[model samples]
Target chain A: MSDSVVLSLAEADSLAREVLEAWGLAPDHAAAVAATMVAGERDGCTSHGLYRLLVATASVEKGVVNPAAVPEVSEPAPALVRVDGKGGFAQLPFSKGLPLLVEKAKAKGIAAMALNNSVHFAALWPEVEALAAEGLVALAFTPNHAWVAPAGGTKPVFGTNPLAFAWPRPGREPFVFDFATTVIARGDIELHRRAGKPVPEDWGYDAQGNPTTDAKSVLDGAMRTFGGHKGSALAAMIELIAGPLIGDMTSAQSIAVDAGRGGSPLGGELIIAIDPAGFLGDRVDEYLAHGETMFAAIEGQGARLPGTRRLAARRESLAKGLAIPAAFHAEILDLLQKGKDHVPNPPQGSRAGSNGAGDGSGGH
Target chain B: MSDSVVLSLAEADSLAREVLEAWGLAPDHAAAVAATMVAGERDGCTSHGLYRLLVATASVEKGVVNPAAVPEVSEPAPALVRVDGKGGFAQLPFSKGLPLLVEKAKAKGIAAMALNNSVHFAALWPEVEALAAEGLVALAFTPNHAWVAPAGGTKPVFGTNPLAFAWPRPGREPFVFDFATTVIARGDIELHRRAGKPVPEDWGYDAQGNPTTDAKSVLDGAMRTFGGHKGSALAAMIELIAGPLIGDMTSAQSIAVDAGRGGSPLGGELIIAIDPAGFLGDRVDEYLAHGETMFAAIEGQGARLPGTRRLAARRESLAKGLAIPAAFHAEILDLLQKGKDHVPNPPQGSRAGSNGAGDGSGGH
Candidate 1:
């Protein structure tokens, strides 16, 4: 009657693991991928949480994703590490490359990791937060399939293009913020359309470059970047730096290759990690302490740091477990019997592929 | 009859040089500093052009800037370069640090330069453009004196933090973008106030955290980030990385130190450079060529890249020369005769110094 089911953290984790493994993922990769899903749920990022399992299952069934692929890491340069995800999910490659990235960052003051050929479905905060946990400042970026347009353009030339950053906080959780450059997630638009509601005028433009509040029109057209041109510029930066700079596919290339498979965003992710001690030497503690004043000022004025909500959610969820929608939970169970039984909709208007513009992958 | 004059770029350069030399800057430092003002002029950025000369003269006369300080560089780590400006302008430190940064990037695949104890008065594009010219992708950030508030807060706790980036385009001008995290320059708002005009409602908030278009009240209060919370997060990132990571002052720290002599932003700048050869190796050309398609898509849709105007201005200025304001040019002349005769008002609000909220230093 409540239309929801409460499950323990362990149960949710097992559920995600089973879904991936059942869909043909190897045990090691399945575990690595499952951790991100569990973490997303624990942090109350429901959009990226357990719902992602359905998307992954769909991709695997459609043969758009390589479920058993092993991530391979190589030292492309002294301060650069390259991780070929072998056309698999990004989580495995990211985990494989973290050690080398952390090592190089510590040795050289800064270092970068380029994860290419991966299907990225996870939110980036977890990737950056992991590096921050190792006492390093981290910034990460990745491009989704092209769906958002440049500020003045009517057609899609850019992706949602998420940028994530984490700053180390010595005694507590790191400061973190990860966000899509688009005004809102494509999934949100789909939800709006499903609810038969109109969206904000600025959310997107139709094919004729006219502003529209119709969710359906936007889904069939292009999304706008947040913050106007500033956000648009940042989105472009993400596309290039994480795209061609890594010799991986751009969002355009990815979506073209996806061609309607409704798989996760397939491209490259660039992660830069810097060791503060490398720059500040023995004075790292002193300077970070000084940084506290700036932090205090933001909160003292009644504003919140971006990561505050996520951290709070993590704590509450860990203590009480995850409460997931009953229907979505049933779908996960159905996925065990038939991986294709529940497929999230594919993205719209970026050549919606065979799925015909269904909102698959939860969100970009 | 005309308020503005069309001066040859050389005239602007020479005028700037004479003012700096008269203010006690060494000839080498003066030449190095004058180049940025001239470049700003050439690129049609009048606010950062010859007008900055008066501000520099004020900083020197007030003893807040060390006009003759020589920048010193050191390599504390293999891929990290540090430049100590010794309280001089950032231009000198950036130049002194660039060679090593390029070398490290070429060797290590990526490198970073941290500039400390510098006065930053110019736009950031030049710094990144220089790196891009070296065939490297680049990113740069610096914190000015605190004048912006976090999106939901009513206090000035962050600088008009600027983020700059450049990507190489082989055989053509590199794609580039440099912008402040704030909605607009503090100087623009000052210009609005001086012109007795109301700014856009979202530009800033007044003392009770109410949205206000009154330029004076907003200036007396706090400016907003360009895109609400997203921009604020970026501003905070700029403060931490360019601030604590480099062992220099955060905007809050910088403003408190200023107590207000209306000097330039005294702080640190972080520059990261990456070599394409390092990532794509021999395939660099192939990938960069592939990147052209993305650019074509953007332009095909009638959208211009951020650097298109600057590139056009640079070519036009190089051919025809700079068009400077006659009033501002005459003010530079006045400064040479009496150091503080024509100081740009320091940045408004954020604790007006002994100068008493006079808009010295033009803007943050």
Candidate 2:
């Protein structure tokens, strides 16, 4: 196994933020990005955590992402919202607009927000889980760069196209789940490749359309949808709903438009929020009770809830510290040093490792 | 093979309506139920078609489904509506209230209708397809009696929770897809049992939680969710949203409440409609064009769209006829004959096979 190191959540967050700051990102943008990365690591999603910092830095350096862009949001109708990310990171617009979305849904029973011109590369759970924490039911869909093939099709025509859903359980953590339409996430395949391991046969197909167990072949070819045609239909649904419905590039369009940039695909995301209180009135508790019964039954049968592992990981990580690869830690530290050279004097209290132990609360 | 008879679309519709009428349903309810049954046959969904007539009749006979009850619709908010099924079949309320739902959604950008106290045994596509026909995007979810086990669990904790989505494709038939979260639908398992065929290993499990290919074992035990944990999460989501959110009996509650009824489970359904015109304005056409490009790309790779097979079956059934088993035909005829003894004076034109060669258009 490769050498690894454990960093406190505070240290990880501070280091990530300082690196982004050195890359010329605005304070708020850097903080938002850093928080998401830290949360990913906290939830045991190493692929979506600090590993993405390199790609994000490269994106900003190559002029593909505007580190200083301000997202603009407009209400087209009582229950309709449009947010233009202005070719910036998705977290910026989502952070700025999601509270407004929750308010609108509360006022109108339900609301839909379309986020366009954004680069989204984080785990989807945080956004929906945030809404659920606000006592609302939320569903979110986003299309990424094309990597999954349609069922029975050899060519990649759809993005991994992840979807997230969350339902509030009142005083408890929300019942949250996020998954890509593919049999497994691209990150899992990448991990397998990095570990020099073979994936399962159902994971993906070779370029010639024959099923293969080689993780490298899957990366070179395409991933297959889960459960045959059902997952394919779901991916297609997400592609249309999150893509063209928001007036952003579909998976195919994203490939065509971003071919020269070699950056992560920029597209739109669709989030629909429903205020249960508005519709169910005081009966929301009864609704939650029914959900409890389901959970109890599932537990009695020895089944874990969808987000159980993540929640467990989060608790452990918060209590201890995030175990990250030693080499990866060194790389981020190097980036931080170079970033300091570019920015010269860092902002007050913005230095890496300054926030010892962190608050270990909120922003998850 | 069992003996069978082929009946034209019109003849099939007329026969189904007359059978329901003879069974003491009001004319409108009979028509609505018959339309759905005929649609099921037209789309090659034999399990939901005439094959289900016996169960419908039994439910009505046992008073589990009130054949004479009237559905009530009330708008709780501008964007929210509630339909009380009054313990009747789902078709009555859905057929009566969905048009209003379309109008409300178009005027308000989005709308939701909670359908409670209804027995939704038919396929969900018809309801969402109706909305798509009116140039709207629609999502529908319904929970049934507990049949599917959650991932890693030995007991059934969820229904074969079905979800349907439809998108308007403008000049062509709407793009519609409906599927249960289970690896296979209960009806397909029944068909396998009837045909004395063994299912695939992933289809279901025995009562002891061991994987099995025996259809009888699955029926006696539980169905497995498709796509492993992801599908389980989806089923759980549908159970919560369609069950508790609508204040109806959840899968477990339905099983408890209906234990003595020996009839189809009754629950709630949640339908959400979105009007592209209200949100996207004239760009609706552009949105559809993008969908077309996706379809073209998928087809280029030798992949068929989700609803392709169903649409083809519908066209063929409309042009030629629906071939149904002779034993099932006789059983329906016998039920109709027995029903005639209960209701002496049938309405004018309420006779089996009377509406021959009816106009082969619309509805679907």
Candidate 3:
């Protein structure tokens, strides 16, 4: 009745690990990276789910990713931790540094982790949610390829930079939300292109600095930021905080480094963690309850919190398994077969430009 | 030609100090608050400038505020500074905590200051600009009265919820922005109401949950957030971080305590400072230069950065002095002549509701 082919969580996990491993990823790196794919699938984020397997095949071509490189972690100061991803995917470095970050946050009341020179490979929610699971508040940011323009300008200057925040709640699911500052994700433009539909006017501008609904021109031109100047300011903040502050690439620099390889974006990531207990001491629960009241007030009026839908989908996906498109499953399988040899050539006719296709396919 | 009266910066400062001192504020409190008022005037933020002195007089009426309470500062953790405002305005506590926060950030790489039970009196830009002036990156947030609604609902569950961020520049003025998450400000609606003008469609919703242009109806209903759902999420984050995270009141709780007394909102403020050297170390200059490249890209496109207009106004104001409205100046002079007794009544019909005229008048 449908194009969907459901995959159990175990099957999904194994499928991701196997494809990544066949491309010469080390067991440690493959497992950490595979978790992102399975988590995405389980959470109903089709953009970042097993669909990224095909995107990975295109990115993992020879000499691009250091599939075997090990991430290094160090605490350069009392409340700051540094992670050198060594040109590998960010997952391993994040996994390696998380415990130390949590520990330092508990010790100092506030802590930050600078993950530098890493290839971004997943959504930020998982990372921040992990901190919330440890009963800490968390914020994370990273610069992507230069796919968006600054406010009031037509040129592509800022990244579709993403910002994520998580807050811990007692005896319930932690509230989490991760979204791009861009009006729409680049993947959506590709979707419109494939479907032969025009995008919304607010989404992007044409090469002549005019608003355009034609998906192709928007892809060729520049995407606009959400909320206009306010969003532009946030994008700039993300670029500075996650880029230079962590000693990594800005969006423009990132694309220049990318240069038509269809690889994952290379840059830095910043994670800040705060321990409420440090400020509230024994009164933590009292204030957390106050947060619940605000939550109730929002829901009482039929308003949903940012991650409400994701959580609902998560529960459904957990119970009934993931429903991925059958065609995508075949593409992933085809990628699994051909990618075993790890061909260096870019995917045939799939990528549009240096910053094209899966450039935004993996992260939501 | 214009109905404006020029006031030298020194004269403006003295006028503010004398008015507040006459209202029974301690000399220290008066001086600290006077600086914010003058800075706003210098930077062309007329909302938070000397006009706030009028708002303050209304809020400071009766025994609601502690005219002479010294803030107490404590370091409960290595990276946390706590300031008990003791029913006083936030300015004094922020000033009291700034040095300790700077020391902690330098020593530990990151530090946070929590000011609890304080009354907000100015825009957040000055606090963050001060930190950037000290060579540290800073972020600040505080909840105003609950005058704004969440993304999809009509009831006002969230405050205007202003967020401010500042990054230190090597030699140039720091990149600073302080703004509410609302689409427009509550004060703008009042301005529209007085002029009998229809507000923009995106500004607010009426009591029936339909977008309305009637400023009075919108004010009676609720204002909308800046970027729809994304901005709503930010407002929620601000409420948690600045509210519950600091063991203070939520906007709803704050208003409940205020009881429509026409006073400044009562709550907590959270300020986080990050030492760039902690992350970049000796390579700090190299990375800061990387940030400059991004700034050049933005400016080269002829797109101005946030706070750009304010900085330009600051220079002109310094050279030419501030031009206050002649009528407003006369009113202040009259209040100054008769306010020596520190009357306790809330200022006439100039005040509106619990979250009335000046609720958003002092912060941009």
Candidate 4:
């Protein structure tokens, strides 16, 4: 307790919403972006939290994230949809697309969407969890720029491409698991950089193609694949699926195209949503219940679920007040409170969708 | 080379093909199975090579795998299909289904198939590699009977649930990667059992829910997840996608059903295939080239692509007569040369698809 601060979930969400709004994102997208960020924080994923606001806002300012653009279906099939994110925020397309997939999968059992040209918003848990809430299982994959080395090879050939999965449990925590295929995510490396700490030797190779413990080299070199070639292979596969198949720019090419332009740093995303009930029939309930019983058994001692620790942290914060390091808070207040004059926002009277909430698909 | 045994690839394929034919599998299927199995042996993956033949034959004899059944597409979409294996050997369905996916994806950019009721064969890499050769990237997920523990659960709740990915590279080995999400595949347990060895404590759980080193307990209880809960979450996700979605038997229920019937052991599988050239235009070559360059750095001195070693071994074996272990050769001969009442086959009249040939798909 001595080392913690708390904020009510409501307050944190409100602040997150306000921050996005201030950055000129449409109100609905703002809410999603905010909620996702807060959810990450609540779920204990600080790296993907509010700290990303500045970068996201900067991308929007650069015209890479079109807050007003709407995601459109580029191709349609029973089992898959190709979505053009239209330079909109990644969350918008994912939010809109997931529901559509759920709908179709309910009829057809399973459906997938290939998302192109969207920015990375935050951790993938929020979207998957949201889908799980609708009684559908969901999984998503996204590939960032080439930042990881293939096993035995050096040079950033692949991104920290990550995979996220969520399954509904009967009456327990919705099972959620998300992770980067790389040995270390770029954010983790950044954390190490900020702390002036050395990274694990196994995590990366230096620009010289030699294994090294230096964190800074990761910026210029490559993160090692997780578990050597196994991880490298997985990352490569993820890139293939989430990158080109989604019809998005991939690997070093995307970065080169965006060079100096400071475009939206969003990578490509591929998501699949499945309606378990379609195939499991009445057994869905029993299946999920069994999952919960088993999960609870595993939670026996002092361990926690993949995202539960974050939820617990979030609860504590909500019960108290959100903890913002004094410096970070001061920095936020300075930029947000005083920089309002410099920020550009959409003209005031544009209706924010029907419920005064923006639909998840459309941009600014 | 002291620890290595070199066998000519052609000789290996021929011998394996001979043994499989003796097992009552068609010649074509035998060729494909032999190819996959020997490929693993060639690539240094002894664990998945010749060792799998016995189990496969057992499954066939037990009437779990129909050597003659044809794999058929029950439902088809531009980007997806549902495959009914008709209790055929898993290799046949996978081999057939993979190419169908590749062809459809090439025509439409992406394709996926859910395979139901198939028996296990060899590793999933050969199929992935074939897809890569077809200039398509491939991902395959297979959920078997539960043998791995959930995070906190004492008993097993998932099978090893192997996942694999392969991407075509411009001037190097296709980026093939395959792994079991569990700390160990059940095959490893069987190996330990044969060797009368104890497994590492971290690999499995005891009946009371604590980690144990006894492989026997692991067999009796459950294998531990690869990285604990993270692995469990992944396994759960794979199960949802590969098992229930495929309209095949799933989890404990499926195993229980099999046990009750006293039949062949089998599970469902999900395969997702993407044609990179279908979407990347000229960018595909560049992306692959960049991947190679990146990996070239990591290749440092002696690093190899995930599947390259095996492919190399296959090449070498093809050049030289394959050398089979005296023990395995003896075993195969004993079965093939069984003393009496053996029906000699009219080679030319063998079932058309039964030879186990044609690019490892095992399509009947």
Candidate whose DockQ is highest: 3
What value does DockQ give for candidate 4?
A: 0.21
What is the iRMS for every candidate structure? 4.8, 6.9, 4.6, 6.4
**Of 3 and 4, which scores higher on DockQ?**
3
True contacts kept of each: 0.84, 0.64, 0.83, 0.24
Native contacts recovered by model 1: 0.84
Q: State the lDDT of candidate 1 residue by residue for A1-364, as single tens digits.
A: 3898888888988988888887778788889888999899999888889888877776776766667666778888999999887677889989999999999999999999998777888899999999999999999999988889898897888889999999988799999999999989898999999999999998998877789999989977899999888899999999988988887777888887777666787778999999998878887887788677788999998999998998999999988888888998898888876743544333232221211111122222
lDDT of 2 by residue, A1-364 (tens): 3587888999899989999989888888899999999999999887788988987887776666777667777777788877777667889889888888888888878888887777777888999998998998999999888788999887888999988999988688899999999998887898899999999998888888888999999987899999799899999999988877666668777766565566776778889988887657766786678788888999888899989999999999989898887888899989878766763322211111212111101111
* Candidate 1 off by > 4 Å: A1-3, A340-364, B1-6, B339-364
Q: Candidate 2: give the clashing pairs.
A: none
TM-score of chain A of 1: 0.91
The estimated TM-scores of all candidates read 0.92, 0.91, 0.93, 0.78
Deviation of model 1 at B69, angstroms = 1.0
- Tens digits of per-residue lDDT, candidate 4, A162-212, equal 888888876555777888887667878878888999999888888988888
Error of 3 at B166 (Å): 0.7
Candidate 3 local accuracy as lDDT? 0.83
Candidate 2 segments whose C-alpha is farther than 4 A from its true place: A1-8, A323-326, A341-364, B1-6, B325-327, B343-364
Q: What is the lDDT of residue B295 in candidate 4?
A: 51
Q: In candidate 4, how many Å is residue A278 off?
A: 5.7
Candidate lDDT (C-alpha), each: 0.83, 0.81, 0.83, 0.66
Number of colliding residue pairs in each model: 12, 0, 0, 51
Ranking by TM-score: 3, 1, 2, 4
